[model samples]
Target: MREFDYDLFVIGGGSGGVRAARVAAGETGAKVGLAEESRYGGTCVIRGCVPKKLMVFASEFSGLSEDAGLYGWDVTGGAFDWGRFSTRLNGELDRLEGVYRKLLSASGVDTFDCRATLKDPHTVSLANGEEKTAKHILVATGGRPVRPDMNNADLGMVSDDIFHQETLPKSILIVGGGYIACEFACILHGLGVEVTLYYRGAQILRGFDEEARGLIAESMRERGIDLHIGTNIVEMDCAGSDDSDTGMGGPIQDTGETVGDSGMSHRGRQSGDTSDGPIRVKATNGSSRVFDRVLFATGRRPNTDGMGLEELGVKLGRGGQIEVDAYSQTAVPSIYAIGDVTDRVNLTPVAIREGMAFVETVFKGNPTPVDHALIPSAVFTQPELGTVGMNEEDAREQEEIDVYCTSFRPMQTAFIGKPDRVLMKLIVSKANRKVLGCHIVAPNAGEMIQLAGIAIKMGATKEDFDRTVAVHPTMSEEIVTMRNPVRSA
Candidate 1:
């Protein structure tokens, strides 16, 4: 008899777990069992990238008519219908979850639809009071959005709650400056909501290239996002919760709208909105205002609580991320992890790559290590920010470098007298003329960066880029045509 019931048992049905389970079972002919407490597709498909990107697309339509009018087309725009868009978005998520299930079944992997915890190094206990033994256990429980720790903070919603909002608020106060906060600030503004963003920092998108993030911040303000730097909410309470005056103004009057079955009243007021009214917020700048909703896109933490990991001697980092080796193996052999749980690279593609590498090392015996260098990523803010490799500041600190950058109004929007501008920048090493980094800020920047990522990954030099012919009349062509370094650092 075999020592364990299965060769491999996976936890969390997110992208990383699903990919590893399917590949191991189908290709290596290993017995695999997988469990998921929530939806199969996890954050990206159900509540994150997929749904959020669709919302971004829906939000962009609020400006299409004006741009079309400039091009001599009489296109009329209508009020955004949140109900109609949300219905279709949920339908797409359902279809995707079904697809994830079908793939696992086709691979002959045993699937359990419940929460799982480690009973021991090689044992898994399911929520249904069942135990499964495997020769190996892979944890890819993923991460979750978290709210800040402050009084009455629970009243605010997180990124996950944004998807389930039955209707868009008339006005929202978003607290943070990360990609999630910035993206939604732009998204809600485009969808016709009054968006006020408060960040307790000098600038937004802190770790990104300074020039790129500066342009994004300027563009957000130009597009009507009331972005305030070095400011944050000092206090917040539901309107009329306290009778004391805020000094700037007295208590806000109730709208007298009856709460609906969805807990929201007339229009897009929140469940927190009572007969007394919406939420009242006091900012660090001592200004007070009322908002229909308050969203906290502060940050995310790995899902590792009560998983029986620490008991088995698995090391967890300060951020609660599982500490794993080059092959994604934990301190205890026979246990592994990947994806957001590891916190190496939080992107979906990075997790998938880590999973495949884990399989290659353990199942295939080829001992492959995860390759995380030169990964390209994008921030889906208005006039999206796409970047690959080091930024100018970091490159300059490490070695002498040349920075080539240009910003100009693109032809399409320029002809219409629109003020939209596109940026193309490259950071090159002075020693070998290697293109150390590339950053683009414009529409579809994410798509352009993927093709550029290939050349950077192959160690393409500045001369190599110069030798390549430019695609005329394209914003990306600036990358190849710029003959001189605008500045050196």
Candidate 2:
């Protein structure tokens, strides 16, 4: 057999790639090499999860100050300094990136600061014109935010660009109904930006529980976010251009230009000025407006372009996601993939888990298949939502379910005369009494669901939760105290 330069080659310095490389090299003493074209920490640490959560924490203070005033404290709200916060946030991310690099180096994994692509099944080519071969190759390039293919789409910024903005916009128009859009809408609104949200769908957060989403929508509106449902941006142009003069009154005409088979558009030439000016937007709901900035949190696509995977006969989905088996192995037995590139449960923690599983399966001689079910997730809106397992809508479709739900004003907000309400729902399987789902919509819902997730994951039933004693004077106590089912279907 031909000797390869390394035992395993990981292309991508993101969480999955880094984890797999470090573990395989450190634990199994494999000759591992990894490459990262961009920042080492990937999306979650660099721009996606960490920085976003910091902004969420900053956004909460505005409300906290108001509640403090109600508690007889002379509290006052101050102006938000985006520059200071952004600087601090960037410094923290840089520190984290250094930590990731240190971990890889300590594990004896050869790190390449350049891009890596496949030369063949066994050979990897780096951007620095170096080619090295490995016994096994792993792809974990991850994904990128996608903008809609409309007129002047490039004029709008994606989620990744939000971190790099020099200053927060005075007013912003956020498009899309997903968690990203809603979270930013709330975050920016809290930071004193005149925020407006437009979702083409009838409601935001389409896949979540209906009751939970309904309350979120109500809270967002109450918090002064101008939300428009069943609407989308048909055209966008820079202010003070010929295209910008298009009347604000009629519904936007459909371009009829279909998205190609690749599900992405060849980015069109940008029109109008690209300076610091308002952007003119015409919506499908027959309205026109100009905003300081437009953010397209529309969606994301797998980062599998121009990697030579297709030519190598690796099966790819329509979205450019790498097709892999339970073992994360591709058709080419020596090749494997994990994380968002595989498009399996696109969460940061899930990617890390998949990476660990990949290392165990390939190097440790323990065949491990990644578990993708019942993963806990949270959306950091004004009133956050945390969920695990199947939602009520999906659970009812699969089996007979009894939903035990409660929505009431929490003690903290009720005491302050704030109209904030919380929701706790448990979807129980009627036949087996197993808790099919646990969904919480409240402040600190994310923290609450982490513990609740453990029970539901262990096949906890309604009786199991009921038997547990309640924590007094707490919102979570309702999860254990609700005895009867609200409805069954």
Candidate 3:
């Protein structure tokens, strides 16, 4: 008789969990079972990356007509039908969730479409009170968007709520300066909505290269994003409520509609609720305004709450992230965790790689450790920002470095008299000549950085980049042509 019902059972049917379960069951021939309380593809497919990128694409069209006009084409912009786009977007998400299910089924992995929590180190208890035993268990429960702790804070929408928004608001107050906040700020602005962003920090994109982030902030302000630094929400309430008074003068004029029940007021516009009016907000700067919606892009936390993890002796970080070793093994040898649950490199690709590493270690006996260094990331703001390796600020603090940087208006929009600028910068180590970082801020910067990431990952040096011939009339050619170090630190 088998000692356990399955060889491996995964909790959380996300990219990491699904990848690990499929590989272990199909390739390694291990009996596997997986469970997810929500959609199978988790945040990336359902909410975070895929849907938001589509929104970025939809939002980009709002500015194309003017650029096209400069190119001698009489293309005029048209109204954006959120209904049509959202319908298609939701359809796409449904298809993706189905694909995730099909992949697991084809791999011969058993999948339970319900929440599963740890009953013990090797035992999982499903929401239906069914118990499943496995020789090894992997937790990939992903992260979730969280609202700030404040009165009436529930009135604001989180990143997950964006996909379900049936209609776009006329004006939105996006709180936070992270990539999520900035991306949506640009996105909504492009979609013809008034976007006001408030971040209680000196600058947006705080940890990125200073020069790159500065340029992005400049471009965003130029593009009409009402961005305010060192600003945050002091109080918020549904427009016209008795407690919605802003000490600036008096309460914002009520539109004669009462606040809807629960969180429905935020999404009430979807149902064309006349009673659902804008949200009144008072800022730290002693300003008062009402926005059709208030989006809190502050942060995310790992989905480890009430999972019975701490009871099983699994170490959880301050952020509720499951603490695991190099091989993704927990304090209890039978339990393992990966993906956002581990909170190490929270990108989708990193989670998938961690899942693969977990399978290699626990199932194949190879004991592979997760390698997280030199990971490339992109902020999908207007013009986009793609970066790989250390930022200039961090690199200089660690060791001596040479920074080769260039900023210019690219030819594509330059001829049109558009002030759209792009930046290409490389940070090189003084001692080893290795390119420590590459940062690009321009159109399709995300795509350009992926190619550059390969060279940097292989330890390509500044001379190696210089020796490569420049492709003429190309902005990227500057990567190879720049010879002198603009600055060293």
Candidate 4:
């Protein structure tokens, strides 16, 4: 019933918006408002990070079941309840949503659990037609899945839709080659499902260090995942005879060449459904297989649609992410945006930093630009991939870089007798011997990279890494004792 609602208004209850609202409310003791159409915690908490990590753990643990004997544990034929796993995932997400809500409320920020449409730089209208006016506004609405229209009529779903899936697929064909695709590939393959990952590019994990990418690929194959690189989907329709209505997958090809025998040969032909019957899919390489489900983890774009940003004249770049400067300020001076919406280093922690920076510049009278360098990230593949700083390829492309790297099978594998190897790489500026990039692919690489990130942020050099003695019998020590530095002219 308050006529004038808040001093600060935040749209999109994702990471950036939430952080800004919380800090602004707590520090300034100002009445802050936040609005979210979806469940709180944004993509990272609800979909991207939390649920994905859980799925990865489920997948990895299934593999651990096989390696349990090596760790002195025995396992008979054990059953896994996909339903239980999915239920637990949902519970964790719910708990996280509750925690996010509590944080906002406890910090004295009022939240509107509805969509926020900007009426002006200062005014936002909610779904219930309730309007709030503020001195400043921030938008942090995150991205969503871009579903393919051609593959639409089939039973396949995108990365976002897979978490709440009703049934665990016996076999799944995941299309696309980005992190989301690769991450889910690790998850499904770890879950013991027959998984075939298709990437349109030559390599799966692009932008990471090449050696780490190779290592992850090798581990994936060792774990029995079928990776189809340089493959694509051309057309899809439902598999059914005498029924022209539904969609089916046709044939799958590799590099424009047919590979395997069509498994749907026995289904018989149907009118308007091609020679293959219903529930059929066709790959560009001309090989066809019937899968229980198809998944696409291609990539993500910014979520600047339908929230009335066009009317407000918000400019977007690089897949519709709002363009912002150092202080997270958009073109419109009074309006601000951060997090995935800004598309600058689309990580949760990065968003939080930008949010805090916004508050400092606006309310605290001190300005700091968002620094993305040395931001550590992890890809939870088996023998998990972690990185802070630049990899050799990116470093070379960006600057004159000297590279040092090593690959060794972990010692645990020496006892358990698995041949899968861990690969680590460092990119140092040849001009200054600065440790600009650190990359690793190994078990717990994500956790291991944290220390490396701190070192890199502290301006550690290759010599600094070498000056530190190597810790024996651990996979992480490769970072310190990189002997040969490969210089790129």
Off by more than 4 A, model 2: 244-275
lDDT score of residue 400 within candidate 1:
98
lDDT of 2 by residue, 315-362 (tens): 999888899999999989999998888887888888888889999998
Model 3 bad stretches (over 4 Å): 244-275
lDDT of 4 by residue, 85-199 (tens): 9888889889988998999999989888877788877789899889889888888786665545453433466556677667677888888766677778878877768889877
> Which candidate's TM-score is highest?
2
Off by over 4 Å in 4: 1-4, 149-154, 241-278, 486-489
Clashes of each: 0, 0, 0, 27
* Residue-wise C-alpha lDDT for candidate 3, range 47-124, written one tens digit per residue: 778888999999999878988888889997889999999999989989998999999999999989888889898899
Task: Report the C-alpha lDDT of model 1 over 1-489, residue by residue, as the tens digit.
Answer: 659989999998888889999999999999999988878887788777888899999999999999998888998889999999989998999999899899999999999988899989989999999999999999988877666666666667777778777778899998888888899999999999999998888888888899999999999998999999888887788887754633333222111110000000111223333222378898878898999888877777778888999999999999788999999999999999998888788888888898899899889999999999999888899999999999999999999999999999999888988788888999999999899999999999999999999999999999999999999989899989989989998
Worst 10 residues of 4 by lDDT: 257-266
Candidate 3 global CA lDDT score: 0.84
CA shift of 252, model 1, Å: 24
RMSD of 4: 7.2
**RMSD values, in order shown:** 6.3, 4.1, 5.7, 7.2
For candidate 3, the per-residue lDDT at 470 reads: 90
